[model samples]
Target: MNSGAPSSGLDTEGLYRVSGNKADQENIQLLFDKDHTVDFRSLGISVHSVTGALKSFFTALPEPLIPYEQQKSLADAVGIENEKDMITALQDVVKKLPQIHYDVFKFIITHLHRVYQHNQNNKMTSENLSICFWPTLMKPNFTDMASITATLVSRTPIQPFILHCPTIFRSRLEPNSFLQPAEGKLIDIEAEPGNL
Candidate 1:
């Protein structure tokens, strides 16, 4: 929202609203076009490479895949880190997310992963990219799912590809249980747990 660029339209019902003049808006809109951006291969559906604001915008949809209204609950859900709880919460939110939103999440994450491998050249990590794209990535609640993604990446070492997977972000407690912080007890043995 801080881009200061006028919003060309609003993304509602899991849609992307590209901001700018009509032409720029139209050009960015091609992202939704199956012919221009979508790709499906052995692994799964993929987004042909594209970069900059368009990619950022795709990742920064106004209505988060988690939904604007659910921010508070997400804190608890993401905190618990129980795979089943996380998965259940995510499944609930994802069901409410429009199909278009799902596609965009998939598309942006795919592109970001490819970008990460070469991030050294670009000097952008998942955390940095998420910040730069903050304007587009934020939700109405003034928070971003990317922030969570960055936290996950920083707390432990994981493949860049894993960072881009919506499922991982949605159901965060994977790869050595990073999603759920350490819980309970602080006897001599428990002095300072990592997740605490």
Candidate 2:
């Protein structure tokens, strides 16, 4: 009487939360390959599709592993302005993250900065970034004792604000952050950091 494929309790209504297919595996490998370069725009990769692929890759891994604690520590360490200290702090944090998280986080740290730079040149906004990015890679709402609580609470798959809203969050920081000029100047601090 059933016309559809047989059910597998592993998935949801026949839809899998994660996939380990050949294509996905290749994407993941391409993402973190030490020798291979990953330029989304240069490679003609669709931003939306890239996010989907990243999510699939992350979900496909074994479970009971969220880097909430490690991510928090890393974030706090990265806050420090000292480069050497930051690297040491980052190393410590990396050691704390789960295996999958360490891989994903390292990949993100190395690659996401490029994506952010590209997005900046395109004048991409936070909402646009979210639409083009995925938050699962960074573990939404992740937290630990040493770091700030992750604020990625978006129901949408794309969560740039939580992931890294270079456009939007930067402005939020400007109004309150020390990046502003010590002497008051008649300029839009929120417009651009260097402009003021």
Q: What C-alpha lDDT values do all the predictions have?
A: 0.37, 0.39
Query: Which residue pairs show collisions in model 1?
Result: none
Per-model TM-score versus the true fold? 0.40, 0.37
Q: Give the distance in Å from residue 161's predicted Cα in candidate 1 to where it truly belongs.
A: 9.1
| Candidate 2 residue-wise lDDT, 1-196, digit = tens | 1101111111121121223355644664566465344433333333334344555556555442345545455456546567556555555555676665544443443233323344444443334443433344444544434223433223332232223423322322335333233568322211111100
Off by over 4 Å in 2: 1-47, 56-66, 81-83, 124-134, 141-196
Give the local distance difference test score of model 2: 0.39
CA deviation > 4 Å runs, candidate 1? 1-50, 55-66, 73-96, 142-196
Report backbone clashes per prediction: 0, 0
RMSD (CA, Å), each prediction: 16.4, 15.9
